[model samples]
Target chain A: MPPFDLKDRAAIAGAGASAYGRRLMRSAIDLAADAIAAALDDAGLARERLDGMIVTFGSPIGADADTLAQVLNLKLRAYNQTWAHGRFTASAIQWAALMVAGGMADYVACLASVSFSGLRRPMMGGAGNSEGAREAGGSHGEDPVFGMTSPGAGAALVARRYFERFGATSAQLAAIPVAFRKHAALNSAAIMREPFSAGDHQASRFVCEPLHLLDYCLINDGAACVIVTSAERARDLRKPPVHIAGMQPLPAGREEFIWAYPGFGVAQQSVFDYDAGAPPVYKMAGVGPRDIDALFTYDAFSILAWMALERFGFCKPGEAAGFTQDGRIELGGALPMNVNGGLLSEAHIMGWNHQVEIVRQLRGECGPRQVAGAEVIQWANAYGDSLIYHR
Target chain B: MAANQDDYAKPRPAISALNRPYWDALRRRELVLQRCGECGMRWYPAAPLCPRCWSRRIEWTPASGRGRVNSWVVFHQSYFRGFDAEIPYNVAEVELEEGPRLLTNLIGVGAGEIRAGMEVEVVFDDAAADLTLAKFRPRRGAA
Candidate 1:
């Protein structure tokens, strides 16, 4: 199959998520069952029709593909799993799209379920996740030898670098979390519903210096599933098809930091002036950043929202600090983002929640938090993977 | 149970065949990085081949032991029990003269005082008899 043929050929048919909460005290498969069933039901897809699965955060924290199939009575024909990383959410959706388009699977459920409460110590760092003990170092640039542990620690480093490079202040970065919380106040399913002000953000203690506690995301238990099928099959389903207009796969290299943009220089990347120069997702979708009605990113940390904004040509390298201010990214703003409150205020289902929200918003299913007259929505990220979804 | 004063409770680098030499050099109080003999590209956290040239012709030589703090962060929360005593310790990503960045803790400066572009030099910490850590301290006579 030709590559460009994939543009708008595949799409999200349905989306659903389990309850988002701290210490839900449920097994991963139990939570996964709730998400998978809800997603299948949302599309009017029978449980027997769901034949493929791409499970992220699978293994120690979530349900594995094989285990989920066996326990859930699923007869999957194609299944794959990635390590417990939120960044894999985009990769899973992209693969599911290809699988559906290529006749490998008719229906693919891309989802993640995480139970962070069960672990005695949080897996953010020196815990069962083995993040710090990986070969060379952790994906987040964690070098435990120097006590540089946790993914947030890496993001804090990027935040500090960005502040120095752009002359931005921690006070300015507060706009991101503050804005997301406002969106959360409207989202009943969101975990952090209480609204907060910039003063509250400033009053919050620093988990890692330069990053307040609010800048970090909520580590809660939940499962979110988005079902993928060919655009032809999706149109036949219950809901309007959320077409996969464009896809930019995840990238990694010396220049690529998992949490920072290409030239922003977090890990092995060099320092330079970054020009986001028409990211391929926009081109594949035949649209520009300006055409995006609603934008959703993997907001594991508030700094990442800044990174994603600058990464996909939405703003200049250092301009996101200002571009995100004055309710710019909130609902009713010029460009609303994360109307479901995102991982920061919603829940971290390894970014599967963002996918669910994207599907809902594209379908105009998001009631109060919906972007009015929204036809195009995007799942862009700091790590350079993106999917442009249009209804 | 009494805590072993002699035991190193902190997380240590899992010395593998690939990065054993990097740790060995640190144990010797000498800072060394893989300098690709073919492409002359140097890097850290040790790789088997040159990342740039993909050449196996690599040599480990003494580094300048000097760099500037590229970025830094302070950990107010402890992830490792061994580090709980130093709850607010700072970790600085130093950009070396060879153009590779290393994540290390800076001595001779408090967490609040460290700034980006501050000149620093590598200092060895004999963390354990079998393990050594490469730390950095602010360089003298630097503006």
Candidate 2:
């Protein structure tokens, strides 16, 4: 796939997110509705105007995309719930933008939510029926049977591989949570906003090997949505449309299984596979990594954020630890990744808060935690599974 | 005193139209997954259309079961009640010889025994009733 630039094709007119943290009283459906309404309110666009709806897959809730569209009374041309592995949050929005550009719909509402607070039981068992969906297992379905069900375990394998390949240590990986919590200290909305030190992260009890409790993402209930429309229509809206300067997703590629130890012989799934959509976003936006005013990448796990930076060409693969160690990713540095405190401190709303942060940065609205005089912003997500979505 | 043997057991996940092939293939101890005949895309949680090509021409193929060790972790914590006996076990990302990478457990090796780029062969652990879990053992000289 050849890379192309989306100079001024689609724009994000409005974005919204529900309050982060535990909300056991709220059902997942209510949370989705709340988030959808919040986004429409932000865009100053009526709910009736929404013609398209895109949702996420793997959400514990059984509400399908069509069901949500009907309940919201969203009379639209297309409605699809994308595979829900965090990274696609922004990718789903990009898909909505493409649909609108292609005339499939005029206005699209992209929604994602999670009910982590209510998940008292360990995440295991089959992924019951949904749209075109089979239970999430490998070729064998053995892991599910053996109770290896949490995203944490799957991610831990990646983290271990990362360290093994790069010769990094557990202490180095600890720097990711340390940096995020430091930034979270300035974010009032962040769940674990207290300042943390390297010592603090190392001292936290181990949740999985080479991964201490701090290395994991927070399990909280939350939802987020964004409204997208054609750039021309956005001009007449209530708010100054945040132009969708560029959108990029992984290129489609063939897979060859290498299920051995550190399977690097074949690229199972990496940024290399992403369909070359908009040029490296920074270039298409007429900015470079250093010029990025504010940055937001999915923080389902801090390692994801670190890997994204490396893949985006901000730092060399193994050099991310050193760059993070120097406080470059924190506020007042060259770039402030996740200004709204990412999923780690903020609500783990399927990485929707990351999107909220990008809009807030472009609008210059984040208060004490805000980066000063922010102009261009970047938002990216890496799904827990093989699917990679970048926009 | 032990009560009736099966009283407390959780019911098995029912096999339906969507997953019959996957369950049947597993019961036969052959790992099968769908691949796009047009785009050559492989998928788990099999679906009809290729996510990349949008082609409904997907074929189910058995995997080679030989892969390199892409990544791994030694888990010191247990979450699922069924995983209680698996404390300190190794979870691995095996890049199958067939060209797909998956999350599975590695057995027949100690924590220090596993390393990046090591060749591993799939071995079945049929602990659960009617289920054969895919586990891996280190290829000799892989260390």
Candidate 3:
């Protein structure tokens, strides 16, 4: 295997997000079209210029590349859709970049859109009938006869183990949402702008034990999209292009459905396996975590932030709680993590919004939420795809 | 509650040819795992080929029915309607002595008392008529 180098072949020219709220009162296709249009507009490119596109497989109403193409009325030379769930966003950007770099397409649009409120079947619906759900319920093999059906429950299990191993408290985990909420206060598009406190987070209801309601990501209905094109072409565009400095997927051979039961030990072991050295993302990107100016880690749940911090080498094992303590992750703090509030307070666009925030921050477009002199940004999704961006 | 009188119309496993033997053994109150005869590798949730060596020489081997809790979660809400009655139940992952991990519930223990590394043994629950499910309980005389 030759060394991978994606230093500056492609860049993100523009990013756009639709209105995020409880119910958008729009079809998934419409929301996707809205985001794509805004992205094209932001890039000063016409719809006809896009020759390739990527959409989320979980799009509400089963919207795929063809559906989005027809909705946007574009004739594309190449297009694809990803079914990897939340992990596909960064990979989608990478694939789109490769297309542009290889001259397969001049410009490509990577999009993720979902309307949970408008869907007949929500994200976790049809639990008992689906094969995956049945497997989760311990109907097969030696699984527990009744396993957790929600991802939040599984995340809670991981959180409990982390707390037990590290002696971390709920009060420490509460800092994540509190800091993001503070950042959300500056984001006009954020869903939860109310000032958050540790007391408030502790007092919030427990969706699953050890994970408070505030610890979970919001389920607001929205979409976000970004336009990727060759760096040379992007330099001539309307906006400052955010270069794709490095991108890589999660390490292979890890277990799936990690949260439903305990063997979470195996997953943690996989992470610890990399403790002796840097993760593949940093190695592939040719930069360390310290090189990042802003961090936009997937925050589907608050515990994930701590996990990413440790897994990505931002801190040592069991030190995330202390590392993030004292507002280190706040807007003006050392790391400036999830400055757009992330999925916890921002709209849940399946981590696509994080990419948008990274682009905006790298462009110095984020007014109040911008990190001072921010030149490099990094975004990692739940499925382990990590990407670093530079101004 | 009577075993046959409970409202147990929950979702049952869509048993297939590959996994039928495992389910059949569970119905008979015996724990079994698939072992690759060629590579001597054992696994759970039966598949046709060995994941390690891709060998077709597989055999059903009786397990020790003993393991330790790797981790667990207490579901505060039910994802399926059939489980609505069993809210706040415990689900655990057990690593058997035979080197396979199975998802099962921890019985005879409070949700708060469950811990990693706790010793547990397999027990069968007839969740529905003719649909026996395997679960785990704390090992007797073991902490």
Please name the candidate that would achieve the greatest lDDT relative to the true structure.
1
List where candidate 3 sits over 4 angstroms from the true fold: A1-4, A59-62, A125-145, A254-264, A267-276, B1-7
List each candidate's DockQ score: 0.79, 0.33, 0.45
Question: How would the candidate models be sorted by DockQ, starting from the highest?
Answer: 1, 3, 2
Where is model 1 more than 4 Å wrong at Cα?
A: A1-4, B1-6
Instruction: Point to the candidate with the largest TM-score.
Output: 1
Please list the residue runs of candidate 2 whose C-alpha ends up more than 4 Å from where it truly belongs after superposition: A1-5, A57-59, A62-64, A118-142, A145-147, A252-283, A383-391, B1-70, B93-109, B117-143
Q: Tell how far residue B43 is off in model 3, in angstroms.
A: 1.7
TM-score of chain B of each: 0.93, 0.78, 0.91
Question: Mind giving the per-residue lDDT tens digits that candidate 2 earns over A37-85?
Answer: 8888988899888888888743564245777776767787887886645
**Residue A355 local lDDT, model 3:** 86
Residues B22-121 of candidate 2: C-alpha lDDT, one tens digit per residue:
6677767877778898988776555767768889888888877777888776667754445566677777777776666666777777878788778998
Cα DockQ of the candidate 1 complex: 0.79
**Under CAPRI classification, how is model 2 graded?**
acceptable
lDDT of 1 by residue, A217-241 (tens): 9988989999999999988899998
Tens-place lDDT digits, model 3, residues A1-391: 4455678778999899888888777887877888888999999998899889988644444357887777668989988887635656777888898888778889898988877778665454235223244432322122223645556766776787788767899999999999999999999989888887999999998777888889988977788899999899999999988898788765444243332111235322222233515667677667888888889987888988887777667877678899999988997788989999999998788888888888888878889888999988888643456888888
